[model samples]
Target: MKHRTPRGFKRIPAWMFHSRLPVDAETRLITSYLLTSGSANHPTVSELSDALCMDAKTVRRNVYKLEELGLLKVIRRAK
Candidate 1:
């Protein structure tokens, strides 16, 4: 599935920046990294893990949190 940016926003996957709840520096840092270094060229989790020194699974989980907050969308593949 293609993850297109929502209307009136950069394609940058930055949900933490404009979150309703306050986000910590670590989350903001990760969001910034994703916005700059990430591209459709690679998986978001992979890029985030490398930049934040976190496991890809952890990145996936946090991104889901962003999705749940209506800040972004998560695309799922057919099993």
Candidate 2:
């Protein structure tokens, strides 16, 4: 039987896992979550922390690491 993916689920690219970039487990988890989160409703640091069951500081630190590695980008909206 063919397996069907759940509706509204984001599909991670295979290249992301096979890339030469060095991504730690936490970074990978964060990246995947971010990728799956819809553009209109991206979770905040606190939300991610709660979802991942990690400290907010830890989540922030990993987010920065992912940014440094070019896996994530921060865009500021004008107030």
Winner by lDDT: 2
lDDT digits (tens) for residues 1-79 of candidate 2: 9744345545545565566777667776776667666563457899999877899998999888767765565321210
For every candidate in turn, the CA RMSD to the true structure comes to: 9.7, 5.6
Can you write out model 1's per-residue Cα lDDT over 1-79, one digit (the tens) per residue?
9755434333433533566565555444544444444344345688668867888887777776656654443222100
Off by over 4 Å in 1: 1-25, 38-42, 73-79
Q: Which stretches of model 2 miss by more than 4 angstroms?
A: 1-11, 17-20, 39-42, 74-79
Model 1 TM-score (2 dp): 0.47
lDDT of 2 at 43: 74
lDDT of 1: 0.53
Model 2, residue 46: displacement in angstroms?
0.6
Q: Each candidate: how many clashes?
A: 0, 0
lDDT agreement with native, every candidate: 0.53, 0.66
TM-score of each: 0.47, 0.61
